[model samples]
Target: MNLFRAASLVSFLTLLSRITGLVREQMVAAMFGASAVTDAFNVAFRLPNLLRRLFAEGAFSQAFIPLFAATRARDGDAATRDLLDAVASVLVAVLLAVSILGVVFAPVLLWLMASGLQAEDQALWMTRVMFPYILLMSLVALAAGVLNTWKKFVVPAATPVLLNLSMIACAALLAPWFRRHGIEPIYAMAVGVMIGGVLQLAVQLPALWRLGMVPRLHLTPGGLRRSWHHPGVRHVLRQMAPAILGVSVAQISLLINTQLASHVGPGAVSWLTYADRLMEFPTALLGVALGVVLLPQLSAARAKNELGQYSQLLDWGLRLVLLFSLPCAVALLLFGEPLVAVLYHYGAFRPVDVAETVVSLQGYGVGLLGLVAIKVLAPGFYAQQNLRTPVKIAVAVLVLTQLLNIYTVPRFGQAGLALSIGIAALCNAGLLLTGLLRGGLYQPQPGWGLLVLRIVIAALLLAGALYWMQHHWSWLTLPKGQRVAIVSGCLAASVGLYFAALALLGLPWWRMLRRAAL
Candidate 1:
């Protein structure tokens, strides 16, 4: 398989998801601004997301995919199908119980997540409404894992676009309808979220069905018990034990940060969230795209005992990480205010909000390389079924993050929170890379020094260009269309300049495609 081609497919689809996602956020910020109700929605929405990461994408995917790949390799289609059924049965039962508990404990969850929220009742109501989204997303994650293992990457990659479109529709249309009906307009966002979840899950089914990999869910008490005892199910649970610890450490950090942001002020959470939406564009386009493509491939290589292939994959992914993420980090740090102004300076969103969000965006940009690098590095341990190492590293990073927050938050406010996370990410990525090298799991390829030099030179040129563009425009004072036009032109020019500089510096631009042919 061409890894570059696969990663490119995921990246292109993810770009669509991120574009629609920005439009969704733009609508939300325009209609609501960084108000109390928007904070409520951010807090309420995070409830299921925290759990979804823990249960579905985080621990579950880390544990399930490697084992699933290995099982399919060692056994046959029949055995793999039975394993899927067993896993799906247990997963469904667990999700149902959790969703119910979440709804019943909505108030407690909201308070725990954001006790300082001014609109507690509104948050509680939205929390209850959106809590069950975890159920839908978990199933979607399951289908994604299956489809990805089969190298059917398109459907899962495209699934997020549906959610983004759903929210975009709700924010544009449903929000106004709610206002007319004397209902809270922000409540429509929660409704849109659930709608999106359903659509996301619905699309995954047909994809799975086409591959004949649809899991036959068993809900009966006897059937559930039998599934719980299945060997494959037990194996997955065992893997998840450490995987959960690893994932929980990261989620717990987010939980703490959310709690902290709530205390900062009304718009604090929204500011950080808006900045996160922008950060996620490049992170998803490059980092997530590579991670999704690499994990299954790494697992397959490991299962076959192809040690050389495993290391080569890591090397390729890391090089791509440095080559692409450097220019993005530079752009985010240097050009954030203009990006924020053009995308969000509308309706209720004010000039003040733009300034506040720019601080957080730059903080996030400070560690963009590390943040993206982790997406590639952690899978090195996960593909080897060594979840404990990353868990141990995460525990230390968690402590370090909070310590930084203690020093920074009181001094710099919510931007400090973002800065702490970014700094911690750099440390986390460094430790992971060190572990891989010391264990001889990865050997750096030759010419890395030259590669780094060329990338640095290219990034410097890109940074200079962005700095010039940022100063030349009075982005906040400009009309919307003019602002959009200039920002779009600057982005195009910046990308072109970065790649042209890399080419002139003797970097092999075609090597990414050519290496994949091997």
Candidate 2:
């Protein structure tokens, strides 16, 4: 497929998954509120998710895909099949071992990540109940990498929808049972996660089967030992080690936030979780969609020594992210409270919960551009097999996060944690962009500066218009009206204002749209 077609497919599927996820989060907020149970669930869910990113999505894909692509290109179908079987064999054994360890030491792991939670036996119990999801999801990750290599982006991208669907079902149907029975609803959520992982893995099976790449059980090493000796695999490993570490730095920021939130108050962790869900809507829809679709194309181009195509593709990806993300960031900053109120204003979630969550969401929204930039740029380094730079930068950002957490948490509470993370993301993105420029891998195309200027102007105008509407409509004063009027109005005005400003600035929204169409 062409680059635009590939990106469109990925983006459309990701947008669907993100919308379902929003609905799921809304259900969660309504049922659980910003409470201790929600906090426990967040910690439990994060543990598996962090590992999923670190090993499954981040390191494994970075290391596996380039080699997989090479194998597909040079060695043909047999070689690819053998490689898949061998890798699958090793992966199952490794994931099983890790899962056993996690189940056995669930409490200890929870304590280390959220030390303050050690005092709360309830949190520990919920964590143990949810810990087995790590194994199921690791397997799912491997399957996803295999699918991505096959250029079957649709299934893997759509798999996340299963997770949200499962959670929503549990929250809407099963949560009441737990509540009436006096059992923690968090346990139900944990069970939903395990089921979600299973479904995620299962959904990809049909695609794999159609590709004739279904991996069979093989205790023997098969091509696995050869993969260890393959020069391409070795190169991938070399790049992946540092990339994994770098990715972990982002996860570390979340872990630290959770740990600190655990100490802040009863629902601080939940508040942060709620805010992050809002932030992730745009990040996943635009940033992750671009990164996942672009990386493989970039890697293939780099392999073929087509530096110009690689650079152009990266540039296009960045432009796409900026076009969508900047305006979304602006809207988030202006209407965070109204958005939070609309999504999470029911059940046990109250106006106070809305207030705290909005503060965190705005803090996070401030760094949304940087967060998306990191997603778009890191893949450039990974595609080039240079992971150490990102790792070093990540470590530096981690140190900054710690320092800020220490200084800010005492005064600003949950908002401080969010701000620290946002600042660190900006730092990481800046370093990545600098490195890309220094390596001469990125150059501004003609009119690039003018395009960026137009984007900035449009975003500012949209923000201003939203601000005016919110004040004149008294959006904050009318709680019920604020939910519908503020969110819908801000979104509508931002869309109109941004596009109108872009037109006024002579940026060809139509031409660009036509190019995307073509």
Candidate 3:
């Protein structure tokens, strides 16, 4: 499949996953609300997720996918499997060691993430119980990278539904069981996480076996020695180390946000996580799904020395991301409160929680464009086998984000935490784009200025419409059924009106989007 078609398929699956994820979040919020227990679960879950993003999605994909694609294109299956086996062997060995240490020093990790919270021990205990999720998810990411390389997009894209289902089931079923036994339901949630991680890995294994590319674990020293010394494996290791440092710096800022929010008060961390999750709905749907589809295409383009196609592909990805991400961000800013209230206000969630969450959600919405840009831009560097540039930028972004937090947190509280991330994301995206242009690796297509203007105009109109509708209805005071019905109508109208505005401005996407199919 071409980039657009492949991306659309991935996006559709991701939309499904994100919808399920929202349901999962709704269940969790209803059960635990944004209290200390939920806050602890967020920290524990985030510890693994942070590493998963850094290693699985960041370092591993940056290093592994290009080489794997090239190997498959040139040397065929045997050679590709050799590279896969070698990488898998080393990955398992290292992640196992890290997981052991994480579990052993779980308190240290918690102390780092939640030192200011008076009940740090609660989150710390959960972190220990859930720490091994890192090991399970690392393998899952490796499997996903392999599947995407083979053009098996649907399975990898749909894998997260398993996680959402696992969490939802545990929250609904096992939470009560744990409560009956005088245990915090959060512990059941943690156990659900480990089980979900395992299920995610299991689903992908059969696909690999079918492709004749399932990696055989070789944990013995001789096995590790043989794998690590290969020239291809060594090159992968070299790229991965720098790439890890690059993404690790950005993740550090998030952990810092967690720590700072922990100090702010109860539910601050939960608030930040909730707001971030809502933002992820669009980021995952567009930027992330496109990133997943683009890398293999980019890698193949570079391998064939098709620089023009590479530039065109990058330009298309960026334009599409900006076109969709901007309006979505605006919608979040315009409708955050009602969205949060309808989705989460129940059981233990109070009015104040919704109000604070809306503030942070808007803050995060400001950086949505930047966050999406980085997904497409970073891969531009990675596919070219240049990891150092992003690492440098990431380090700078890390400092910038922390400095912003230092200034913002004292006055803004949870909103400050979210704002720091948004500002840093914008800065990071700008630097990445600058480096790409200066390096001459990505040449901007003509008509960018005009295209951007049309998007801006349409977004402004859409925002205005949404703002008017938000005030027109007292959404929160209505019955639950009425609230859902009105919100759905408003959302549909917002999207339809935005597209109509774009069409009126002579930027009809239906025709243009199909051209991107090639």
Best candidate (score: lDDT): 1
Q: lDDT per residue, candidate 2, 67-153, as tens digits?
A: 676677678889878777766766666677777787788878898778765335666766666666766676676677677767788
Best by TM-score: 1
Per-residue CA lDDT of model 1 for 1-518, tens digit only, reads 58898899999999999999999999999999999999999999999999999999999999999998888877878899999999999999999999999999898888889999999989999999999999999999989999999999999999999998998888888989999999999999999999999999999988888878999988899999999999999989999999999999999999999999999999999999999999998889989999999998889889999888899999999999998899999999999999999999999999899999999999899989999999999999999999999999999999999999999899888999999999999999999999999988899889899999999999998988999999998999998899989999999999999999989988886685534532
TM-score of 3: 0.98
- lDDT (CA) per prediction: 0.93, 0.78, 0.86
- On TM-score, the stronger of 2 and 3 is 3
Ranking by TM-score: 1, 3, 2
Candidate 3: Cα lDDT at 215: 93
Select the stronger candidate by lDDT from 1 and 2: 1
TM-scores vs. true structure, each candidate: 0.99, 0.93, 0.98
User: Lowest-scoring 10 consecutive residues by lDDT in candidate 2?
Assistant: 509-518
